[model samples]
Target: MTGLGWVGQVLTVEITGFAHGGLGVARHDGRVVFVRGALPDERVTARVVDDRKAAFCHAELVEVLTPSVHRIDPVCPAAAAGAGCCDLSFVTGSHGRELKSRALADQLRRIGGVDWEGVVEPIGSSDTDAPQVGWRTRVRLAVDADGRLGYHRHGSDEVIAQTDCAQPVAGLTDGLAGLGGLRPGTELVVSIDDAVGDAAPARQIVQIAAPSRGRGRQRRRPRTGPPRVIEGGPTTLRRVGERMWQVPVTGFWQAHRDAALVYSDVVTGWASTGAEVAVGWDLYGGVGVLAGALRDAGVAQVWTAEGDATATAVAVNSFADDSGVHPVTGSTETVVTGLPRPGVVVADPPRSGAGRAVVAAICAAGPDTVIHVGCDPAALARDLRLFAEHGYRVRDIRGFDAFPLTHHVEAIAVLNRDR
Candidate 1:
């Protein structure tokens, strides 16, 4: 079919492979069709939902003629109903990890020009019988027209109201019912910090943000202010290893319960390659988590730069007892230029993956060791390719199934400058 004729057409195709973003790859009429709710080696009838591109199209699974053995009932009821919380929840945890591993390897080879033969390791418990639930400590929901809290539908702005989402830890969403007079189309961010020993009591915070107003059909108004805390205090306590940080509720933190600890441990191991390293840089550091890890590795001085001023203030206050740690508030690309020369650099940039300029800047600094962390596979691959161009060779790389039951994977790459 040609032009818009493929839109709304139904075709039965064999899902031969998996694609990024939790899609199955199929071909019909010499064009690639990305089908949702299908798995590899499965035969399914799908309806094309979008055909904007000439080379590829998007389709929704209508019926499964054959299913893979790895397919299972989704633990989340909302996910079964097309909610966006858990796109890969229909598959077993092992299968999910395998798919993520393959996707990462594909991106690395195709985009980064590096071959990968690594697996995406699971974070918590290895028991096969254990259900992957109650791992998310943070969740964000959108308000529908009737002022009900729900997640956005997959690939759409429509809200799927659900109270029993299986991803969040218990008591995280308990305050949703108590919230009164919520505005429609607003966003609700709920975060819970479970108490550890005598450190502090369990705390949950709920913050609401007004919907962005658009001047036209395509232009959205920039956010003028931060989200307002409605239920709890402005900040929540997060404990990674023995260190605890007071992070703003609206600030960035790992959603999985064990993600911070796992990433921190990896960073510490890779960053402690040399003894008596003088200075280290933590770019896009949120609340100085990795900076503390650097300190644990015996780095004499550490500079952490973040754009969010609120998070930076928290980092400043949290690291006050340690004079060796410094928090700078500015964009990573700009602040990196003014930082001191470093023996090591740890960059945990946002999903965009520290584009070309930041990578070039880091390369120019000539750090002996650089640890790059990325949440998106494609962006990470592109950034890795950039590092290759700068003469930084990848020494080691690891992938973590941080976001279980989802297609998202966290990867860390340790690179060293060639002599």
Candidate 2:
């Protein structure tokens, strides 16, 4: 195989299924090939992009010999041209969820070693009835050297030129056209509060020009002082679950417009089904959204731990004297042990998921219930296994099409201590 010059080589393969990262899997000469811009059960001619020794070779779709019936003309050029924004947008949102559910099951079985032979419940509420397009509430637009704004091409830092992105909130799409006055080569981070059922007056916009430092690798710099607000004040208001949350432009929040309410409802519903909570811990809580939800659900006290100073400050300001809400500024792994043990624990860690130390801390605390909200399936699966080792068993899990028209899916896995 090392002797074969695989780059630029064209091969006809029948796509059997999709892998976790939204790539179609096929076989060529007994070697697994991953092809982008192709769907399951479709035969296509793909050109080798990376033939280096890997778990599987990578290929790019050149021409579709047999297109799937579900394939349609992609609305976004980035996806159609294979710039890697939304390759699965060619299929309907419902079908995308089915594929995502299947991929999640595969990840759990292969990586987490858990054969969850059950249905992954689809999560949605009354607020989300419109189409999946223009669902993103927050977006970070990249700035190229030539003063163009768009997303980066797949696997490269070169920002692709684009006219308009159909994924962001409709207001954001309108706002981008007016941002031509900004300086060249400056990234802009923006958030829109145009959730479903909100009126035009309730809709708000907040944006900031990120400080660019020679674009090597994008790493989040710890906020030392107040964030330099360029557009709309220092903090922006995000309405979630009948309450408004003050979120800094740089702070973390759900990208999907309806994710906040859906997640809060799911978490609180799971908590309400079990024993009443004297106290609950919201690890990695951002702006106290879930903490507030837990408190509203009759929890006597909710202690939320967050690492970002700005976000924690916003959380504290948003619930300063609520008497039931306590916002602490620290990482969950280090701060979780400092708090008293509670009846319930809600952890929504980043894409990395909660590591072993945090899981150990939660397990050591002996909470009766644990709700893990994860964006990445592989990380969620690994953490689920760790939680199982610590005497907690998965009671129920639900997957949400929060990020519709995309491969990314959010899941909430509820675990209870096995007696």
Per-model lDDT: 0.86, 0.77
TM-score of each: 0.94, 0.90
Expressed as tens digits, the lDDT of each residue in 122-159 for candidate 1 is 88758453347888888888888998888888767788
Which structure among the candidates has the greatest lDDT? Answer: 1
- Residue-level error in angstroms, candidate 1, position 374: 0.6
Candidate 2, residue 373: how far the Cα is off, in Å: 0.6
Q: Determine which window of 10 residues in candidate 2 has minimal summed lDDT.
A: 122-131
Q: Clashing residue pairs, candidate 1?
A: none
Best candidate per TM-score, number? Answer: 1
Clash count for candidate 2 is 0
Model 1 off-target regions past 4 Å? 1-4, 128-131, 175-179, 198-201, 211-228
Report lDDT (Cα) of residue 398, candidate 2: 84
What's each prediction's clash count?
Answer: 0, 0
